[model samples]
Target: MLDVGSGTGALTRVLRAEAAGDVVAVDADPKLLDHVEGPTVVGDAFRLPFPEDTFDLVICQALLINLPEPVDALREFARVSRDGVAVIEPDNGSVTVDSTVGGESALAGQAREHYLAGVDTDVTLGSDAESILADAGLDSIEVTRYDHDRTISPPYDEADVESARRKASGDGLATDRETMLDGGLTADGYDSLRQRWRQMGRDVIEQMAERTYERTETVPFYVAVGQV
Candidate 1:
C-alpha cells in the first residue's frame, strides 16, 4: 500500500499495524516524514516517484482538498495503484461547531466563511471525490460518509489550555488576517470581528476558570474509493 501525503505518519502508523504487507509513506516534507517508523519517501502527490502499477492500493487522507488540481492528483494516484485509489477528505462547508461561550459559534462561522472564500483550494471537496475519481477515468467508485466529532469540556488538557490562550490573544485570527482580507472582508469589518472574537475568547477563558467551558465540533469526512 502507498500512503501519499502521509504527513507525520498518522494514517501510516494505523495502516502499518493492520496491513498484511508493507506500507510505504510518501510526503513532500521530509521533516514530517522523519517521524514515521518504517519506509518513507519524500515526493510530490502529482509526481509520485514510484513506477506504474506499483502498489495494490494508493490512498491519501485530508490531502486532495489542499491541492490546486485534485483530479490530476487522483490520476497520478491511479497510475501507481494496480487495484484501487482512495481518499479520505473532509467537507468543511458542512462542519458544525458549538460552544458554551456566547457568540463563539457565530463568530467561528463568520471566520470560516472568510477563510473559505479566500482559500485557493477546495476545502469542502469531500462530497465531490466520487465524481472527481470518475473524471480521472477510475471505475467502481464508492464513497462513505463519516462524522469526526471532537468535544472539549471539563478536565481541560494542556492542548486545550493552549488553544484558549491563542484565542484570547487573537493570534489565531491574526494569522488569517491576510486571507480574510483577500476574501473580501473589509478592513473595518475584520477589526470589528476581531474585537468580538477576543471578547468571546475572554468569555471562554472565564468559563474554563470555572470549569464550565464546553465545545463540540463535528466535521464530515468522506472515504472515496475507486478501482484503477
Candidate 2:
C-alpha cells in the first residue's frame, strides 16, 4: 500500500494498523516523512517516483481539496497502483453549522457563500469525486460518504475558553479576509464581509461570557475508490 501526500502519516498509520502489509508513506515534505514508521519516500503527487503498478493500493486524505489539479494527482495514483486508488476529501460547500448563539448560524452561511464563490480550487469536489474518477479512466468506481460531527457544548473546557477568547480578538475574521482576498474578493467586498464576521464573532464571545455558547458542525467527507 502507498499513501500519497501522507502528511504526518495519519492515514499511513491507519493503513499500517488495519491492513496486513507494509504501508509506504510518500510526502513532498521531508520533515513530515522523517517521522513516518516503516518505509518513507519524498515524492510529489503530480509525479510519483516509483515504477508503474508499484503498489497494490494508493490512498490520500484531505489532499485534493487544496490541489489545483486533482485529476492529475488521481491519474498519477492510478498509474502507481495496480489494484485500486482511494482519495478522501471534504465537501466544504455542504458543511452545516448549528449554533445556540444568535446570528452565528446566519453568519456562517454567509461566510460559506463567499468562500465557495471566491476559492480557486474545487472545494466541493468531495461530492464530485466519482465523476472525477470516471474522467481519470478508472473502472468500478465507488463513492462513500462520511459525516464528521464536531460539537461544542457547556461546561466549557480550556480549549473552549481559549477559542472564545480568540474569537473576541477577531483572528478568524482576519484570516477569512485574507483567504477571501486571495480568492479574488475585492477590497470593498472584503470590508463588508469582515464587518459582518467581526460582529458575529463579538456576539459569540458575549454568549461565551454568559456561559451560553454552544455549537455543532457537520462536515461531510467522501471516499472515492476506483480500480486501475
Candidate 3:
C-alpha cells in the first residue's frame, strides 16, 4: 500500500498496522516524514521517486487540494499503482460555517473565504475525483460521499475563541490579528468571533443530540476508488 503525502503518518500508522504487505509513506514535507515509523520517503507528489506499478493500492487524503498540479499528481498515483487507488478530499465548495448572527462578521466571513480560496488548487477537482481517476485511465471507478460533524461544549471559553482567532490569522486567511479582534472585518480585525460560532455550535449540537434540530451542519467529502 502507498500512502501519498502521508502527513505525520496519521493514515500511514493505521495502514502499517493493518496491511499485510509493506506500507510506504511518502510526502514532500520532510518534517512530517521524519516522525513516520513505517518505510518512509520524502519526495515531491508531482514526481514520485518510485518504479512504475510499484504499489497495489495507493491512498491519498487531503492532498490533492495542496498540490500545484493535481492532475499530474493523480497521473503519478495511477502510474505507480498496479491494482487500485483511493483518494479522500474535502469538498470546499460545499463548506458552510453557520453563525447565530445570520452570518459571520465581515472579517470572519472574509477570513473564511480567503482560507478556502488559498487552497483552491487543492480542491479545484474536489467534486471530480472520480473523473480524475477515469481520466488517468483507471477502471471501475466508484465515488462515495462522507460527511463528518463535531461540536464542542462548555469548554468554549475566551481562550478557545482566541486560539481559533490566532489560527485563522496565522493561516493567512485574515489580513491581521487586530482586524479579526476588532470585528472590523478587515484582514487585521481580531475581535472574538467565538460567541457567534459557539452559539451556532450549540444549536447544531442540540439539534443533533435531541433529534429535534432537523437542520444539520455537515462537512462533505469525496472518496474515489478505482482499479488501474
Candidate 4:
C-alpha cells in the first residue's frame, strides 16, 4: 500500500498496524517523511514518483481537499496502483455545530463562508469523490461516509486548554486576514470578519470561564474507492 501526502505518517501508521502489506509513506515534506515507520519516499500527488502498476493499493487521507483538481491526483494514483485507489476527504460544507452559546454557531457559519470563498482548492469534495473517481476513468468505484464528532463540554481536555490560551490572546482569530484575502475577500470585508471572529472568541472565553459554554462539532468525511 502506498500512502501519498503522508504528512506526519498519521494514516500511514494506521495502515502499517492494521493492513497486511508493504506500507510505503510518500510526502513532499522530508521532515514528515522522517517520522514514517516503514519505507518512505518524497513525492508529489500530481505526479507520484513510482512506475505504473507498482502497488496493489494507493491511498491518501485528507489529501483531496487541498488539491486544485482532485481528479488529477486520483488519476496519478490510478496510474501508480495496479489494483485499487482510495481517498479519504472531508465535506466542509456539511459540518454541523451545536453550542450552548448564543452566537457561536452563527459566527462559525460566517467564518466557514469566508474560508470556502478564499481558499484556492475545492475543500468540500468529500462525498463527491466517487464522481471524481468515475471521471478519472476508474472502474468499480465505491464510496463510504464517516461522520466524526468532536465535542467540548465540562472537564475540558488538553485541546480545550490550548483553545483557552488562543482565545486569551485572540491568536487564531488574528491569523484570518491572509486566508480571507486569498479566499477573495476584500480588505474591508476581511476587517469586518476579523472583528467579528475576535468578538466571538472573546464571548467564548467569557462563557468558558463561567463554565456555561458547551459545543459539539460534527464533520463529515468520505472514503472513495476505485479499481484500476
**Model number with the top lDDT:** 1
- Residue-level lDDT of model 4, residues 1-228, one tens digit each, is 999999999999889889997999999999988887758999999989899999999999998899888888999999999999999999998888888877778877877877777788888999788899999999998899989998888777789867756754657766765776777778887667667666766777788788887888899999988999
Q: Is candidate 1 or candidate 4 better by lDDT?
A: 1
Native-vs-model 1 lDDT? 0.94
lDDT per residue, candidate 1, 1-228, as tens digits? 999999999999999998889999999999999899769999999999999999999999999999999999999999999999999999998888989987998899999999899999999999898898999999999999999999999999998988898888899899999999999999999999999988888999999999999999999999999999
On the 0 to 100 scale, the lDDT of residue 82 in model 3 is 89
Q: Positional deviation of 124 in candidate 2, in angstroms?
A: 0.7
Q: Rank the candidates by TM-score, best first.
A: 1, 4, 2, 3
- Regions more than 4 Å wrong, model 2: 182-184
Cα deviation of 116, candidate 3, in Å: 3.8
Q: Which one wins by TM-score: 1 or 2?
A: 1
Higher-scoring candidate on TM-score, 1 or 3: 1
- Local distance difference test values of all predictions, in order: 0.94, 0.86, 0.68, 0.85
The residue ranges of model 1 lying beyond 4 angstroms of the native Cα positions read none
What's the CA error at residue 78 for candidate 3, in Å?
Answer: 1.6
Candidate 3: C-alpha lDDT: 0.68
**Using lDDT as the measure, what is the rank order of every candidate, best first?**
1, 2, 4, 3
lDDT of 1 at 67: 98
| lDDT score for residue 72 of model 1 | 96
lDDT of 2: 0.86
Q: Count the backbone clashes (under 3 Å) in each candidate.
A: 0, 0, 19, 1
Residue range 1-228, candidate 3, lDDT tens digits: 999999899889887778798999999888998889858998888888999999999899889877777767888988888889899887766665443323434434555554554443656466889888888778899998887664434445565454444443443333433433443344322234443444444444444344443322456788999898
- The candidate that achieves the highest TM-score relative to the unseen native structure: 1
